[model samples]
Target: MNTSDEVRTFTVAPDDDGVRLDRWFKRHLPQIGFGTVSKWARTGQIRVDGKRAKPDDRLVAGQQLRVPPGGDAPHKKPREKPALSEAEISQAKDMVITETESAIVLNKPPGLATQGGTGTKTHVDGLLDAFAPGEDEPRPRLVHRLDKDTSGVLLIARTPGSAAHFSKRFSGRSAKKVYWALVVGVPEVHEGVIEAPLAKQPGSGGEKMHVDHEGGQPAKTKYRVVEKAGQKAAWLELEPMTGRTHQLRVHCAAMGNPIVGDGKYGGKDAFLTGSISRKMHLHARRLIIGSPEGGKLDVTAELPEHFAASMEQLGFDIGLSNAEPIRDDPPPKSREEKKQAARLHAKQYRKSRKGERRGRRDATTAKPKPKPKPKAKR
Candidate 1:
């Protein structure tokens, strides 16, 4: 791997697809530092497929990277403690509902964060090291995220190639996700769609979202009422068509009854009285996605204790149904369709710029108001 004295080329594998050039170096050629990569990129010494590439440029599968010599970055000593603690290892092992050669399905518990963030000391990503079969094994990668307070089936790709494949399925909307939530009240319609657009609330530090029909990105959620607890609450099966942040919470709230215990979106109305717990009742009930190995990977997760207890208290059925989940998902766009869309967007952008220039020219070319009126008044 020491090509420090000679030029070398590397082919990007499926594992490295969509990875930034700088990140690729960090993973494949750790001896290269950020400064060295930046210098090489700036000087046209680092090339991707015969073209100079930037550090932030995303690499694709089968692309060749031409690397120049001089990767002499200093090596740092290893940390004293092992990556995973004993408790974290146990927690990670206990959370696994099932495992395969390419994937592991976890029934994540509520309040356990999927990844670390500010003020977060422990999380699923940190605990995943326990699943490593050997020191040389690639660390498991999270295919998707579950909110810190939402528990359910979470998929971990055991290999980088699997990670790349699963990621494509999710981004292409071929992956099917079914969620169950207990809301504060029953929706009027038994089944319906929420077509509200959502955007981040200004000044919330990205913590809140609101409907911004005019300028927001499109978001849609399809929901059906599985059961209702009189007028107090309802059990809903929800499927989000787009993977917008907090789309489910916002959509449910917009429907006049938010998921129970979702205080952020529903405010005080999201709560319910009696023996029911105040924990969020949303769960990722099932996930059906095409595996990298060429078959379907379908897994179901059981509800958490609080969610199950609430169901029992509210007289909702806790058993699984044989009914197939509804999937009206749109098909992935064809390559030609995507190219046409890009062309259309470019044409519209040019038209908009032309209009702006015309408006400016008209304003500057306009005749000045007659000055004689002021003198006559005086």
Candidate 2:
């Protein structure tokens, strides 16, 4: 656990033969997680015969195992946040997945804070640090964040370089961000831009950001009516040109069509607001980050169950978005799927044929002789 001290070495006796050096160190140190041990091994902190060894190296009798001394492991329990609780960790395990070397794409459920504050506990930052604490890097960083109640397309960068690269792209307005939201009213036009300057309201706890005076930062938001219904709700595709806080929510509200379930932005007409779809109707649907290396990096997060259900409830066509184009009306089946379906159909046909034959035989066996025998017995 001591980062300032030299790596501690201990002699493994002949009886301790055949165990993995990394596992042994972990068992002995108890504080070193697999990632830290792997990092040490990568950095030559662990050596065999005065040579660096991989984390999976098998230990020999009398082997001098070197355990590196640097960066203490994260405590068993998060200090500042309880949302990073054991329960949440298990739940988020499947939702958080790495797409590229530097960036991790996560499917955040609504109601979970992307970062912590307010009654917010266990933001995505803590969970990511706990999850992907890269062995090569000391601390991972978040490239961009999501609204506390908005779900999907959250990204975390593992290294500083990657973090900087992604942040620059986002800040420079190069990253293409797409969000799907449900609004209380439909815009007259199918697609349009809202270029309203936004400023923070005084004494607003820094949380409430709104369209302000002549000095506010330039903010623009573009929206498309993905689907529309009279006075019910409309599914929308929102793209923010500037990264002002609450730009989409505020702009939508200003347009007289506030996001559904938005108590802050949605006015008196907001009384008929729908349930918080998948945490909130707002989703970080698609993100495209152009790498300095040239080609663009595109990632998309599908509608979490809640959003999809809300779309279905609102009678909106819960199909593909304008983002990615896929072939076929009802997505085409893969080869494996076709083969499996064919096999199942064949089996069902054979079973049906056998049943039909049995039915015909039973019909033939029901003879007039049975009626005669019954009469004789009577």
Candidate 3:
């Protein structure tokens, strides 16, 4: 290990452009642990362009990154990935809905984990080796995630640069993801926004979430009822405005119409009595996002078997939702724009108050009382 006593500064490369500050360290300075990087950021030791920066802050090309030196090591070779079997490679390729130079859109099926965990041996990440490029190129990376039970459009970045690009779009909430789900009941309102704050439910080992308005992260979902099956269930087009863990599930339950087959959030009520499949009905139907190569990368995934069967059983028309992309609501006002609006409102209020005062003064000064004398003669 070689330690450095002097500070070091490096310019962000174009390839590293939209990556998080911490991820940059992982790529370029593997010797440093995430905890150390976080501590440095918290204490103001790490600076980007002369300003204190957070570990999650996105880095731009040509930005100067100041690093305080202590942990430095000679370059270590990356660990070789285990060779995947032919079966695994076939499984991975079978899931691809569309592929581009920078991305691979997978129509992920239900019950398959995106990445591995305890007892999770088969996963999309494990099979990513099938898509590996040349020996010098990095393996495809996951830009976003979907629940193991909720299936549909999953984007995989083909390179580190594209990974960084896609990750930034997701974190900035610029990417639009549309979901299709069968909920237990129809919402009284056909279309509206569900704005609720969510927090992890207690005692579920952080495996569950609930609406916790008082102390929770802000979450919003815009839902439209595409069709209904009498009073039994409704097919909904859901667009989550803010991404949160299990956001769509929680919001649907919050509206008193839990998604079909999501027993974790809705319990027994989540399932229907008939031929409806007992699998979670949430499917990520479409994704529209900017590509690294310039134009938008819009892809739609076909519905999984269970969801499709349920739709047919419920007499729903697939054509009801043409899957035409809906326009996103305008972005929130910037700080300067909000300040300008406040100033304009204040000016208008002051002007109205002045007009009221002038009216009062004019009424008081009017030669008005000649009026009552003529009424007595009449």
Candidate 4:
């Protein structure tokens, strides 16, 4: 074994298909033991692309894998990014729910982008491309996408046919989509539908969708307020009837209650600042889609830390059993914040005024004609 040599990690490209992790290392580095590879998978040594590669982790024709910096690295410098901690990369790898000959399912975490975009080098799609099995092997391709800030079930198709089939279902609205959002206030109407339109803002080559009435695509969403936030915020369960880019975001915004931590659409309480990011409050909670082979497929994703953090900071009671929010007044208010407070305060004032008006009208209608009886008697 070359003890002092450094090894360069290779993403699972087509040329490296059908190779076992242990076998790949043996070929690449003479006599590294199978036990050593296994230990590395357990520890933080060998990784796939930027993740830890298990000994038995089947090498797809193309997947990204890393050979550790120690032990027989290339003579010249290897052009790879700083290798990921075996733990962080492996954590994502472990979230794959199902994998078949034709596709793979992953519950993507919040904060991880689905594919490479501007200023994003490491993403799920690029890693899949690098780790794919062969030139002839079908690459793992995205059928749909979740927001970089939203965590949820994501589907990948291994074949072109599979990709097309899944795409059709999403386009036709045959996919069952469910989402959970932490928003700023309990709505007056608990269960109602929000129908609105979405327009794409194409200025910075980013996927930012806005609410537009005229030149926008049509969209609709139905929501039931799951839990109220003591007039401050609410936890909502949403079912989108149509699939438009950022449909939920725009609809919520149009309803005058943008989600917490959603800075783009004018969310107040949970806007992104230095510590909080824009993606904290929304999650793709669950998905049910038809499998390429046969029956129904369902997957769920756990709430990522950012969403949880918002919950912690806001103290919104999200309908959990026996969960208690701090029993104190809300934080000190600013002048603008006070104005918004007045708007909510007007709700109670208006309700009392309306009651008083109704009472006066009822009294007027109930007056008797005693004067006519007295005149008849006289």
Off by over 4 Å in 1: 1-82, 320-323, 329-378
- The digit string of per-residue lDDT tens for model 3 on 46-122 reads 99999999999999999999999886654755657878888988999999999988898999999999999999999
Give one digit per residue, the lDDT tens place, for model 4 in 277-345. Answer: 466588777777786677877766677777777666666554452211112233455576577668778
How far off is residue 64 in model 3, in Å?
17
Query: Which of the two, 2 or 4, has more TM-score?
Result: 2
Off by over 4 Å in 2: 1-88, 133-137, 271-279, 292-294, 324-378
Report the C-alpha displacement of residue 26, candidate 2, in angstroms: 28
**What is each predicted model's overall lDDT from 0 to 1?**
0.86, 0.71, 0.89, 0.69
> Which window of ten consecutive residues has the lowest lDDT sum in model 1?
73-82
Kindly report which residue pairs in candidate 1 clash with one another.
none
Count of clashing residue pairs in every prediction? 0, 1, 0, 29
Q: What TM-score would you give candidate 2 relative to the actual structure?
A: 0.61
* Estimated TM-score for each candidate: 0.71, 0.61, 0.71, 0.58
Judging by TM-score, tell me the better candidate of 1 and 2: 1
- Name the 10 consecutive residues with the lowest summed lDDT in model 2: 324-333
